[model samples]
Each structure stands twice: as structure tokens, then as C-alpha cells.
Target chain A: MSQDQKRDAIIEAALKRFAHFGVAKTTMSEIGADLAISKASLYYYFPDKINLYAAVLLHIIHEAEQAYGPLVDQEPDPFKAMDALLKHRTEFIIKYYNVISFIRSKHDIPEELKPVFGSVHASELSRMRKMVEKGVASGRFRVADVADMGSLLFECLEGLRMMYLEQASSFFPTPEQFHNLLKREQQLSQIFFNGLTV
Target chain B: MSQDQKRDAIIEAALKRFAHFGVAKTTMSEIGADLAISKASLYYYFPDKINLYAAVLLHIIHEAEQAYGPLVDQEPDPFKAMDALLKHRTEFIIKYYNVISFIRSKHDIPEELKPVFGSVHASELSRMRKMVEKGVASGRFRVADVADMGSLLFECLEGLRMMYLEQASSFFPTPEQFHNLLKREQQLSQIFFNGLTV
Candidate 1:
């Protein structure tokens, strides 16, 4: 296998272990053993566990970008683009909530990895801004400030996501129920968007 | 002093100490000492520190309700009422973020106090619903579901509040910058309300 392929293999193995046992307990040797590689090889690829963990997060982010990036960029209708983006975001959160929760609880996360989160957020914000700009260019949205409106819309979506995560047990007891909650939230967003467009 | 006055005095003293030293470190004895009361007297009013802490949170909630209740109930314009409520909420958060942060970090908070948070949230949600209903009735809002829209609006405000609290030190490094951020948020809400009313 190529060197890059070996590294990707290691990250894929680490992601599963980290998800199952969590970051605190997952070790380099276990990952190395899973890949039938030496610990030295693993160290060569990622000097420490933190670097591996960050790579796992970045991997998820890249997957999301690949999946949703085109929808934001190529959609003809800005509203539809935003709706797709929000739905994609919700799915991403549900799929990786465990990793997200781990990240939230881990205070010792490296500062270098902090920018990954910020960059992801900035990327999303810029996408929303582009959608707003598209809406205005097409005379579909009456937003006075595309950047501010985009940021607000993104923040509102984030707020809904946070509320859902926080109250998942009580408010959304099952997967179907959670899906319904997301649908309702999306409808609510639709109404807000309609208000903007009108 | 009247019984209610004494309880208020105790809550005030506890709030100060809780703000200064946090819930884990603040003791009933110290609070009683500050108020020139016996530990037993403190216990008479509040069975434990957790109970006392709950009272402190409840006191803050009550003060907020008293301050903003009229605006929600008596305002002639639904949009204006919501605007006022959102602005008031931002101020309340800025004023008491330290206490809110302490409460958020205290995992061992009593179950009884959990309802305090719920009640505050529910009260706010209900107020938002009323405003939406009023707007719909007055032909000022084009909402299909008042409750859902109201819930969404409240969630957006909450999300903004959470973002502000989390990023206060970074995105909003100074008070002036934070205030500007809030103002921009308010304008975003205004655009949303305009969209609804139109």
C-alpha cells in the first residue's frame, strides 16, 4: 500500500475504536495491531493520539463538505440550497454526535485542532452568505445585508441543533421522533425564509 | 423583616457568593454568616445548598419575569413585543452570564432545580407563542403554525445567546464588540419579523 493509503487505513481504524471506547481509552498499539503495522509506523504517521483524533474529525468534515458542498454551490434556488445544507448538517450531527460530544467534553484538545472547527464554521458561513447573495441577485430574497442575514440564519439553525442535542432524551425519544423534530424545525425555517422572500 | 423580605435577602447574599466563589465552593454557613443568621435558620429556609442555589436561580428568573412580563402581555405590536423581549433577554444574559455559566457547569444540580430551568424556558416559549398568535390575529404574521414558529424563534434567540456566551472572549473580545454583535443580531431578527409581517 502507498504511504498515504496506509495513513488513511490507520485513521479509519482509529475512528471506529475512538467512537466505541472513546478517546481516553483508545490507544496507538490497538490501532497499530488492527492494521498489522508496527507502533513505529503509526507514530511516524501520527506522532500522538491527539493528531490522530484531529485527523478523524477532519475526515468527517471532509466527507460532509464533499457531500453537501456541491448542493450549496450548484443549486439554482438559494432557498433550496439552504434547505439541503441544513438537512445535510442535521444528518451529519446525528451521525457523529458521539464524536461531537467527545470533542465537547475533551478540554485537553490541542489548540492546533481548534482552527479546524473554526474553519469548518467559516466555510459553512460563507456558503450561507453565497446562498443569500444568490437570492438577492435573483430578486428572491429581500435581505439588506447578505452576510449578517446568512450568519443569523446559520446561528438559528445551530441553535435548533443544540436544543435538539440537549433535549434529545425528553423531546426526541426515538430516531423517528428526532426526524420529525428536524422536519418541524425545517418547516419553521421555511416560514422564516418565506417571510424574508416576501 | 417580613418573611418574604428575609428570603429575598438570603437569595441576594447567596447570588453574590455564588457568583464570586461558585456553587461548589459556597457554603451555607458563609451565606448565613454574611446575613447574620444561624446555619439552622438558613436550613429552615433552604434544606441544603442545592436548594439554596435553586432559590438563587429562581430569584433571578422571577426578576426577569417581572421586568419583561408587561412587555409581552400588554404591547400593542407583536413584533415590537418580541423585539423588546429579545433585547431584554440579551441584557439579562450579559448581566447574569457568570451565574448561568456556574449553573451550567454544576452537574450535581438538584432535580427540583431542573424544573426551574424548564419553567423559565417554557414561560419564554409561551410568551413567544402569544406574540405570534397576536401577530397572526392582527394579520401581521403569515405563519401556519404559531407554536412551532414561536418555538423556533425562541430557539434562535437561545442559540444566539449560547453562541455569545461561548464566543464572548474570542468573537466579541470587548463589551463594545459584544454589544455590536447583539445589535446586528437584533437587526437580523427585525428582518425576519418583517418577512413574517409582509
Candidate 2:
């Protein structure tokens, strides 16, 4: 196998393990055993556990960006791009919430991984901001401030996702949980549309 | 001091300790020492660390109810009461987010504490639902599904609070820090008013 291919395989395996077992419990040896590689061979690619862990993180961030990277070409109507972006983000959150959580939770990410994540998520943030700003420029969005309005809209969705994660216990009182959540999402969307429509 | 007074004192100390230091690092001996009571005396009040921990949790729940409990009163024209309730909840979250986290992270809280938190939060939930229902009935709220509307509203606020708490590294974006939050609150209120208005 090619060296980078083998490394990427290990990174993917380690991410799945980290997602299920969390960082503390997932052993480097276990990651190697899963790949049918010896611990020594794994160490040859990545120097230590933290290095391997960061590789897993960078891999996910890379994958997430590939899945829903920021808008660059969707300029004629940014809202269309935004609509697609929101849907893309929602799907990513649902499928990779663990990866999302891992990214969200820590400040200890290695410097090597930060540029990748910062560039991707930060670009996505600005891309969405620009889309809102564009709508405002064209007399579409009517909010008092474009950035505040955009942040509020994004946080509303991210907040719902965070609540869903935190209230995974039965304590989450929503009836027909999916229906209830979707209804909430629509309501927030409706409110935004109402407040922001020009 | 009377037995109840001393017991309540101990519970209060334990909760403060738990809130800041978390459950793992919090020691029974430390709680006892904080109260200036002997370990034997502490045991007399509660059988084990778990029991004392539960007692501490229940006390906080009781305080939470005391702090935000009255908004659920059955009365005509409860909008004022609800506004007060939401404001109280906002303050509660701001001041006690850590305490909430402490209680929330526990998997097996004492039986006594469970109902205290569940019933109180459930009552608050019902009150939120009730406020929307009452608003709708009185033609003061939007004509949407009252419960879903209420969940959406709370989820937005809750989501913001949780995000602020979870992503402490990232600051909320703007002059609307407090204003924009209040703005969203106002927007939700406006929607409710529109939905319920004749």
C-alpha cells in the first residue's frame, strides 16, 4: 500500500474508534490491531497517541469540508447557496455529530490541524455571512444588521443541534421527537424569514 | 442549630463544591469540613457520599423552584407573569449554568432529587406550554401549535445559552450580544403575539 494511503486508513479507523470510545479509552494498539498493522508500524507513521488523534481530527475536518465547504461560486443568488449550505450542514451534523462534538469541544487541537479546520469552518462562516450580506445589498434581507442576523440564524440551528445532543436522555420532552424538532426548525426559519424579508 | 437547619447547611455547601469542582474531585470529608461538622455527624444527616450528593442536588432543585417557581400560577392575563418567568430563567441560566451542568452530568442522582428536578422543570415546561396556550386563547399569541411554538422558543434561548457555555472560546458576534438575544426574544414574542392575535 502507498504510505499516505496506509496513513489515511489508520486515520479513518482511529476516528471511528475515537467517536465510539472517546479519546481517553481508545488505545493506539487497538487502532493498529484494527488495521491489521503492528503497533511499531503504526508508530512509524504517527509519532504518538496525540499525533494519531490529531490525524483523525484533521481527517474528519477534511471530510466535513469536502462535504460542505464554504460557497465560492454560487454568486448570482447567495440565498440558493445558503439554502443548500444549511441542508448540507444539517446532514453533516446528524451523521457526524460525534466528529462535530470532538471538533467543538476541545482547544487542545494540534497546530497542524487548526489551519485545516480554521480555514474550512471559518470560510464557511464568512461564506454564509457574505451570502446574508449579499441579500441585504440586493434589498432582500431587511434586518437591522446583516452580521448579527446571520449569527443569530446560524446559532439557532447549531443551538438546536447542541440541545438535541445534550438531551439525548429521556428527559428530552419533545413528543414524536423528530416531528417536534422539525417543527421547531420551521418555526425558527419562519421567524427569520418574517423578520428578515425585505 | 436545629437538625433540619444543619442538614440544609450541609446540602448547600455540597452543591457549591460540586458546582465548581465537579463530583469526582469533591470529597465527602471536604463537604463535612466545609460545614464544620464531624464525619459522624455528616453520616447522621446522610448515609453516604451519594446520599449527601443527592441531598445537595435536591436542595439546589428546591432553590431553583423557589427562584423560578411562581410563574406557573393559574391566572388570567399571564403574559406579564411569563415575561417575568423567562427573565427569571435567563438569569437562572446565566448565574447557574455551572450548577445546572453539575446536576445534569450525573447519571444516577438520588431518587429524592430526581423528582424534585423533574417535577419542577416539567412544571416550568408546562407553564411555557400554558403561556402559549393562554396567549392563543386570549388572542395574544400566534395561532400555531402552542407546544411546538413554545419548544422552539425555549430551544432558541436554550441553544444560545448552551452555545455560550460550551463554546466559551468563541464570543457571540456583536453589539447585539445582549441586544440581539433580547431581539430574538422580542421576535419570538412578536410571533407569539401575531399567531394569537385575532
Candidate 3:
């Protein structure tokens, strides 16, 4: 395999192990053994366990971006685009539920992952802004300040997630809890979007 | 003083000490010292420090209720009432910030305060329901499910607060952070209420 392909292979292997056993319990040796690669090669690629974990998170983010980035143009209707985006986000979060659970705890966030998370946050905000602006351009949304409204909407949705996160007893939320959160998001999003509708 | 007055006095004294020094540092002896009452008298009123802390939280809730209860009728407009209620809620949070900070940390919640906090939470939801119902009755709010919307709004506001609380470096939020939270609440609240308005 090419160098880039080998790195992707390593990340894929590490993601499964980390998701199943959690970051702390899953070690580099186990990951290397899973891929039939030597520990020296794994270390050469990732340097450490934290670096591999950060790469996994970054990989998921890239996957989510690829899945949802075209939603604005594909959907045409801004309202529909936003709804689809949120649905994609929900699915992405649940798909990587166990991996995401590490960040929810707040204490386990690795230093290398902070910038990855920060960039991801900024991109999410920018996406929301673009959606809101699209709606305004289409004369469907009656927003005064598109950027401000976008940030407010994003924060409200985040608050909804945080509400459920706080209520869950375990790091990973139950499916039912995730269901309740999605319902709240839909309900809240409907009302919020209606307010913006002209 | 009568028994009731004595208990209130003890709760009042403990509030000041706990707010300034936090629950970990403040002791029953210091509370009694603040009130010039003996430790025995303090114990008579409150079985232990935990009980006293719970009472203090309850006291503040009662104070907030008394301060904001009439806004639904007093403001004459549902939108205005909610705005005033949210404003009062913000002030109440900032006013008793240090004490409330204890709850934000999550791990420090006293066992005795669980029921008290639960009841306080239920009452807050009930109050929100009442306001939304009043708006619907006045033909101002076009809500299909009054109870659901009320709960959704309350949860959204809470999410806003939690967002900032999670961002804070210390147990208590700084003034600027609180200001930003209030701005987000107002912005989000306006959109939410507009969506509900007829």
C-alpha cells in the first residue's frame, strides 16, 4: 500500500479498537497486532496513542463534512437543507457515538485534539451562517443579522444536545436518550425556523 | 424569636458564609459565629451543614418565586412577561451566583438538596407552562402543545446557561460571560417567542 493508504488503514483499525475498548484501554500494540503491522511502524505513523485518537476524530469530521457539505446546493430550499444538515449531524454523532463520548466527559480531551475540535466548531458555525444566509437570499427567512441568528440557532441546538448529555448517567447516551434529543431538536428547529420565515 | 424565624435566620446567615467561602470551606461553627448563635442552636435549626445548605438553596428559590411570580399577570402581555421573567431569572442567577455555582459543578450536590432541587425544577416548569397557556388563551401564542413548548423553551434557556457554564475556567462565571449568556438568551428567546406568536 502507498504511504497515505497505509496511514488510512492504521486509522481505520485504531477507530474500531478505540470505539470498542475506549481510548485509555486500547493500546498501540493491540492496534498494530490487529493490522499485522509492527509496533515500530505504528509509532512511525502516529507517534503515540493520542495522536492516533486525534486522527480518528479528524477522520470522522472529514466524513461528516463530505456527507453534509453539499446539502445546501442539493436541497435547494434552505429550510430543507438545514433540516437535512441537522439529520446528517445527528447520524454522524450517533455513528461515532462511543468515540464522541470521550469529549463529552471534558476531562479526557487530549491536547492534540483541541485544535481539531476548535476548527470543527468554527466550520459548524460557518455552515450554519451559510444556510441562514441562503434562506435570506431566497426571501424565505426574515432574519435581521444572518451571522448572529446563525450562531444563536447553532447554540440553541447545542444546548439541546448538552441538556441530554447532562441527563445521561453514562458517557455514551442510550438510544432512547438520543431519540429524545432528536425530537427536541426537530421541535425547536421548527419553531426557530418559523420565526425566521417571512 | 419564634422557631420559624430562627430557622430562617440560620439559613440567611449560612447563605452569606457559603456564598463567600463556598460549601467546602464554610462550617456550621462559622455560621453560628456569624449569627452570634451557639453551635447547638444552629444544629437545632439544621441537623447538619448539608441540611443547612439545602435550606439556603430552597430559600433562594422561594425568594426568586416571590420576585417573579406576578409577571404573568403584572406585565399584561405574554411576550413582555417572559422577557421580564427571563430578566429576573438572570438577576437571580447572578445575585446568588456563588451558591448556584455549587450546583453547576454537579459532583458537589448535597443528597439532602436533591428533592429540594427537583421540586424547584418542577415549579419552574409549571410557571413556564402557565405563561405559555396564558399566551395561548390571549390568542398571542399559536402553540399546538402548550406544555411541550413551555418545556422546550425552559430546556433551551437552560442549555444556553450550561453552554457558558461549561466554558468557564472557574466554578463561577465571570461578569462578561454572564453578559454574553444573557445576550444569547435574549436573541434565542426572541426567535422562539416570535415563532409561537400569532
**Each model's DockQ score:** 0.54, 0.32, 0.81
**What local lDDT does model 2 show for residue A18?**
79
Candidate 2 CAPRI classification by DockQ: acceptable
lDDT for each residue of candidate 3 in B14-49, tens digit (9 for 90 to 100) = 899878888778888888988899878888888887
Poorest lDDT segment (10 consecutive residues) of candidate 3 chain B: B101-110
Reference interface contacts recovered per candidate: 0.63, 0.52, 0.80
> For candidate 1, what is the DockQ-based docking class?
medium
> In candidate 1, what are the lDDT values of residues A62-149, reduced to their tens digit?
9988998887789868778767877787788677655655654213346768888778879877886787787888888887777888
Q: Could you say which candidate leads in DockQ?
A: 3
**Model 2: residues >4 Å from true position, as ranges?**
A1-82, A91-121, A138-140, A169-187, B1-42, B48-68, B71-82, B90-116, B169-198
Interface RMSD, every prediction, one decimal place = 2.0, 3.2, 0.6
Off by over 4 Å in 1: A12-34, A91-113, A169-181, B1-5, B12-36, B47-50, B91-112, B169-181
Candidate 2 local distance difference test against the native: 0.64
TM-score of each: 0.80, 0.61, 0.91
Estimate the TM-score for candidate 3: 0.91
Tens digit of per-residue lDDT, candidate 2, span A33-113: 999999889999998877786667667656766765645335546546555555565565555554444443333456666
Model 2: per-residue lDDT, tens digit, B1-198?
999899888888888887788766888899998978899998999888777766665676667667667544555464565666656655655454454444433244456567665766566567667776777777655555678766666677667655554453443233234444555655545544443455
Q: What is the DockQ of the complex in model 2? A: 0.32
Question: Which one is best on lDDT?
Answer: 3
Q: Could you arrange the candidates by lDDT from highest to lowest?
A: 3, 1, 2
